[model samples]
Target: MAAVSRWPENVVVFLYAVFFFHTFSSAQRDPGYTFMHQATTAPIVSYYDYIIVGGGTAGCPLAATLSQNSSVLLLERGGSPYGNTNITDLAAFGVALSDLSPTSPAQRFVSEDGVVSARARVLGGGSCLNAGFYSRAGHDYVRLAGWDARLVNESYQWVEKVVAFQPQMKQWQSAVRDGLVEAGIRPYNGFTYDHMYGTKVGGTIFDQNGHRHTAADLLQYANPSGLTVLLHAPVHQILFNNQEGSKPKAHGVIFMDANGLSHRAYLNRGPNNEVIVSSGALGSPQLLMFSGIGPKEQLDAHNIPVLLDQPLVGLGMSDNPMNAVFVPSPQPVEVSLIEVVGITHNGTYIEAASGENFASGTRTRDYGMFSPRIGQLSTLPPKQRTQEAIDKAVEDMQALPQSAFLGGFILEKIMGPVSTGHLELTSRSPNDNPLVTFNYFKEPEDLQRCVDGMKIIENVIESNSFSSFRFHYLSIVTLLNMTASSPINLLPKHANASRSLEQFCKDTVMTIWHFHGGCVVGRVVDHDYKVMGIDSLRVIDGSTFRNSPGTNPQASVMMLGRYMGVKMLRQRST
Candidate 1:
């Protein structure tokens, strides 16, 4: 027989007991109101008072509010974010964005103009994937959009209570804050959720422990008995009842379950029973076009029946163009994102974030615009541009030795781009991604604004406070010279420096992912968010914004959702 173990008998017994409890107690408790993935055995009912497509940043909150007195079915294409460490942990931020898996929360797509971007496919929408920065929509923006000022304020409070937090600024973010003030963006407003002109620290969704509190957390307000959230439920089509000489009514939706099983949920016969499409900027427009609600000519070409000849459904798309100057630091800095923001007087917004070395093994995705694969200046198929950019990025990374620590100071010019883009159907299939042409810098003024923004960033980096950081400015001129659009002068002293800057803008400008205005309030939807020429359907997401809010949009999007939900509730009551 083997010699008797000398370990304490009580310890051995305790370990065995713990192992047994762990194995059995791991079974999740039914929260009753909690989410259910497609693989689950719970049957989706055939009808509900309201069916919300896309359980995203807007949809989650909207669904919860609507469910207060109505039976609501919230359908989401992606799975829940509960246990996804890639999304919940701030340290894994890049990992979540870079994930190319089919079930990744971030869905990677290439625009028609060859720009690569990833849209949120998971619940909580972009909130699950973004840098977790939060800011209110500008008061001017609220007024311009025709939103009720009082209601919008209340909506912000509703959301802030659940997800917003005041961030404790660390070494790097603190330095950036002082630098922005020194660079002339002054009268530091301190920490606030209000979007104001000047340097200020905004709210963040990340807690002090670096845990992300997503918009999904707002679902806690949901009426458990009235709400049913189905994950992995991709809504393919909005079931409509078209009658002769009458408006097309959205009665239900056809979505696929986790097992690829088809399911349909229809609205109750009540007059107020309706369907709301809160699918995000790209998704809401794509779904509208798919449901034959876009340009008549484009829909005809795709051989789809037109429900509403709404030419503006997928048009007027725009995104904030971002040009980043990377400053490599000699020592490791604390990881942060969008803590201190500088709202420049010159229609620009300068923000700084600290990140790990881009060349580090942990960062698998090629994120920078000048990345060799995606940044190469070549006349290639539009679809190949993103791949090429990635490849070029990889090549550049291969040349750099992995550093122990790298700090990044990013500049984002959030304003003054009048140029707009559009989204069109590449195919009639719902699974086929849309052709998104951001048409960035199509206007000369837009390019000039970007150049001015870049100059401001250079000044901030050269400021006395930031000098101790030992910064090495990555020159846009040198990068442009290497690209196909090379042989251009970007030096400040050059006579045609503006022109060179324009060329550089064309070569290197990429999206900061602040996309908006595909479905304008006045054109596509009314002040109440009701879709024009259609009954019982509304679009209540970023796509409905009349213009970009000149700040991070998560807070605005959530506020809109809450505002719309309250409006609908009051209407139903009356």
Candidate 2:
């Protein structure tokens, strides 16, 4: 009996050795899955080579890449993605989307001062809960930012390989494809092989083995050597070196744990190492202001002591407005994962991966941007309400040129013409969440764009592809009446539409939560992603985008994060 007990003890020692040795081992082989089993706790005050804040879309990749050559500590504000009830399950995600209250980590960030904020709190940040759409921005948009076209294009390509984005080819089945074609929806052939602009094709897929690919999956491929992922570590403020004569340096960060305990991690494992803030659009800006890095007047109004007066830290706010037209399936199409998978396999066709082409040319469409037709509407003021304004908006959307083969297309405008919103400090208590007033649709022109977007949806429904389906023309009035003062409601006056399309157009508006702009790049941070007024403090996330890509912002965010990571690694080596 004594001998048997000794064998058990020896086995335990062997396992321990395996973990200890591999923890510091070379990057050639797989690291035992022991790191994945780490318990959620506040990070210890150990010195790390790099300390990345936020484990969301960009932060996850950033941490993973940096850790390849150095010790990295990633801090996240939410719990692990493993057992989160609201995240792992697909139906649960849909339920989360429909819920009025902000319960999911991503939804919770949208509120400020007891209101819903757009930032997310989770191990994977926005990627954990966002609609898994892997698409890129137009080349023109990148060139417009004064970026070398070749460099920007190369960056796009490099990141695409890192993520290994594979669209759902099976979703493009015969039945769905034939139905779309017969209904006059021209297929966008070679979308994955060439320039995606003007290519009318089916939606791309972002899942593997029927499971959605979140940031966690992307990080897994990065194979970080000495990276530690810390969940439930919400960053409240950035600690800056405020000595009068020295350069303003980012030394550490103040964070609160799930149980509300205070913790801090110095950059470079000291009071002088760099701090990378990948907290995202809503998150990074709020943190900057709290750390005294924004407009002086704005910070003072919120009672936040001034640390730096970088006026553009959170000023260039932007997001796409979404107004969805829900049309029930003609037949009871199963809404399960299996059914979605079956549809893909039998519907349209697609490539397994785009190889080199994945990095070049815009090859997709996001149901977010309010098609190019509604340009200049963002210049309107917030309160100048009028029906003529709405009418003009509708006309602009209707003018979007559609191929003769495709009857019409839906114009989902996420970035409205009116851009009005500001970031304000909600509390000086580092423990309290920052106050964010995204002010969605505060401008009348924004509301007008919503109305126009809906009109476009109505036109798309009129196409033959949907004609045979159980579809109905939702008059603008009916739409408003059905959902007024509701986050889901795009139009409010539709309740009063007198059966006339013209009458319906006079009222109704909606919003699509494709948020962007705050802490916008170029204006907020230097070209290398360092915060303008602070040394050794960099922000690489969606907030650093030069402009809201006229499509989904996920791909853009990921690319930017990857680029920043490469830049940081190069600088550190020097």
Candidate 3:
């Protein structure tokens, strides 16, 4: 709307050419990977049959699937996951999450409730950052979502054939499985991708060689010539055509490249041509608000013009609260993420991971980036505090070990967390994380479920199969027990005195990162994931799910992209 600043084309080309080629070495194996380019090279104006913003977990598969029949454009804010050892190598898993540097593949954000979490910033999205556990949504979740069952299964098969794998059962995982069954969690279901209430071995995205296969790998199925993926392209807003007598329609989108230069991409004028937002649960809602499609009051406060005054745009958010006990192993345990899991009938899930550098990856001092022109801020922090304070904080952070180290095992994670919260934009910038709170255990029912789950974990920890790995000597028992203060402190001495357990649940609540909703179905979007009262637009990511799909959602999420892409293609043909 104002004077447009432009970079000289030659300088733009030269700057990006140097940064682009050298960064994508790890991704060179994928044939379609060559199609990726820095957003700076994107044309000033372009048209596509579909413009999918956020080249993330769901976005990648959706783009690849749709490109088979239509021209598709995928815009991602982060660069390729390639050459990032923290993302690709399974052993180096937590490195990016703890890096916290501006260039890290996973960006850290703290909730208002004080739980620190990471948002995926690489092209493969959370798959590039997570523990790589893969499991399908339970039959109940599928039935509740009102999806076509056959199609959903087919979609799962489609994604699993490429990215999902049967992980080799390692020593630590096998013991955990035995302990869960010994604790009476369920009948052993052996290896399965289906979500069933039992101790079962699920799928993983990591191969035998420990190389992670993220959703980006699904691009191999794409019609390469028809798909254009631009990295370092963050969308600014969704452009709309507000015809006097018609509903507000998403027509195009404006995105900024690496240089912050704006480029516009529009949909081909067809009823079916659409713009999809697959920018995760938090990002999708934030994007909608930034694009002027959320609560009127909030938009007004942010000085953003409202095109559609949807009241529930960022409502009904929930992140499954995960509680864990670090059990130190006397012998070296095999390094593993979640390979074995116990799915309880009471709606809580149990899983474990061992041998990660829980202290986070060790980093060199020249990691972080900052601002205010402090003469080339090399080791600066993102906050505005003094350099001394940040240096101390970084030193403490590097020293901190959130989980057990030296081959210790973590009996971790509980799912559901029916407790909900909401997201509201702090500023109009899409890059800024919105104010969010999971409101963990706010509901009485949610608190009860957590108590029930913790009791199960107590049984598992006390079981014979698990005892061999734990320290038994009373001299050091208190230190090695689930809590340093008391062994099985989550349980009440008097059976019905549950208040202490409930308090413990509140005090130590953390996220398993299975958060979903915000642009929830029936509230923000319809059954088809079309945003209420909006046309030629849809929000199709974890944000639309009323519940987290399975033990882990990446598999279900990737499946959703393929499922919906095929459905849309069918709709177009009809």
Q: Best candidate per lDDT, number?
A: 3
Q: After the best TM-score superposition of candidate 1, give how far the Cα of residue 28 lies from its true spot, in angstroms.
A: 14
Better of 1 and 3 by lDDT: 3
Please list the residue runs of candidate 3 whose C-alpha ends up more than 4 Å from where it truly belongs after superposition.
1-32, 356-404, 407-412, 474-497
CA shift at 392, candidate 3, in angstroms?
7.5
User: What lDDT tens digits, residue by residue, belong to model 1 across residues 25-54?
Assistant: 321212245544562443554789999988
The lDDT, on a scale of 0 to 1, for candidate 3 is: 0.77
Estimated TM-score per prediction?
A: 0.87, 0.69, 0.86
lDDT of 2 by residue, 101-179 (tens): 4235544343321222245666666665554545666566677655556655665675566443444433212233334
lDDT of each: 0.75, 0.52, 0.77
- Which portions of model 2 show Cα errors greater than 4 Å? 1-44, 83-86, 96-104, 109-118, 147-195, 199-205, 269-273, 301-303, 334-411, 415-418, 429-433, 439-452, 471-511
Residue 35 error, candidate 3, Å:
2.1
Most accurate candidate by TM-score: 1
Higher-scoring candidate on lDDT, 1 or 2: 1
Model 1: CA > 4 A from native: 1-35, 39-45, 357-389, 395-399, 471-496
Taking all chains together, the TM-score of candidate 1 against the true structure is 0.87
Q: lDDT per residue, candidate 3, 129-214, as tens digits?
A: 78789999988888989999999999999999888889998777888899999989889999999988889999999877777889
RMSD of each: 5.3, 12.5, 10.7
